[model samples]
Target: MEVLLAVVIGTLYGGGLYLMMRRNLVQLIIGLGLLSHGANLLIFIAAGLRQGGAPIIAEGKKVFLTLPADPLPQALILTSIVISFAVTAFALVLFLRTYQEVGTNDLDEMKETDT
Candidate 1:
């Protein structure tokens, strides 16, 4: 199961990077989405898989496998996901505006301030 998750994460990361290298703004957005998912999956897998876990409490005694999954990673991933969504939305809007004003989606055609 862990192996499978690792494979999935790897595939996603690879595909995201491949897409990100393209000149199209839409493809770049898609790549970022894929990359975010891959990162989330990596964090989840790193937390390990536990079927049963004891509740968190003071003076609570529990073993490693019997304890609840780490909450930190979950929280971080959730926050990251939310931030990613916001960023993606902003990027999409910006991309659309750029497309309209510049008349192209090719990033390479964009000129720097100095140019």
Candidate 2:
């Protein structure tokens, strides 16, 4: 499972970087989204995959009995996902409005509008 996830994450990162280097405004945003997803998955996998075991012990028990899944990584990823979503939405709106005024979705053309 981890191997599969690693491959997927690598693919997403690769595609995201490829799209990010392009000239299209939409593709850049898509790349950013993909990049965020890849990052989130990386974090998740780095935390390790566990099932049916307690990774943490009870408050009073010091023998490390029972294994439970760690919630930190999941919580962190959830927060990151929300932040990435808002950032993506904002980027889309900004790019769309800029494109409308600049008359093109190409970054080269949009750059000319700054002056």
Q: What is the lDDT of residue 69 in candidate 2?
A: 77
Residue-level lDDT for 5 in candidate 1: 94
Candidate 2: where is the Cα deviation over 4 Å?
53-65, 113-115
lDDT for model 1 comes to 0.87
Per-residue lDDT tens digits for candidate 1, residues 15-102, read 9999999999899999999999999999888988665554465455354535565677778899999999999999899989999999
Can you list the residue pairs that collide in candidate 2? 53-67, 54-66, 54-67, 54-68, 55-67, 55-68
Poorest stretch of ten by lDDT in candidate 1: 57-66
lDDT of 2 by residue, 1-115 (tens): 9999999999999999999999999999999999999999999999998884656676897866757778899999999999999999999999989888888888877555486
Worst 10 residues of 2 by lDDT: 106-115
Which pairs clash in the backbone of model 1? Answer: none
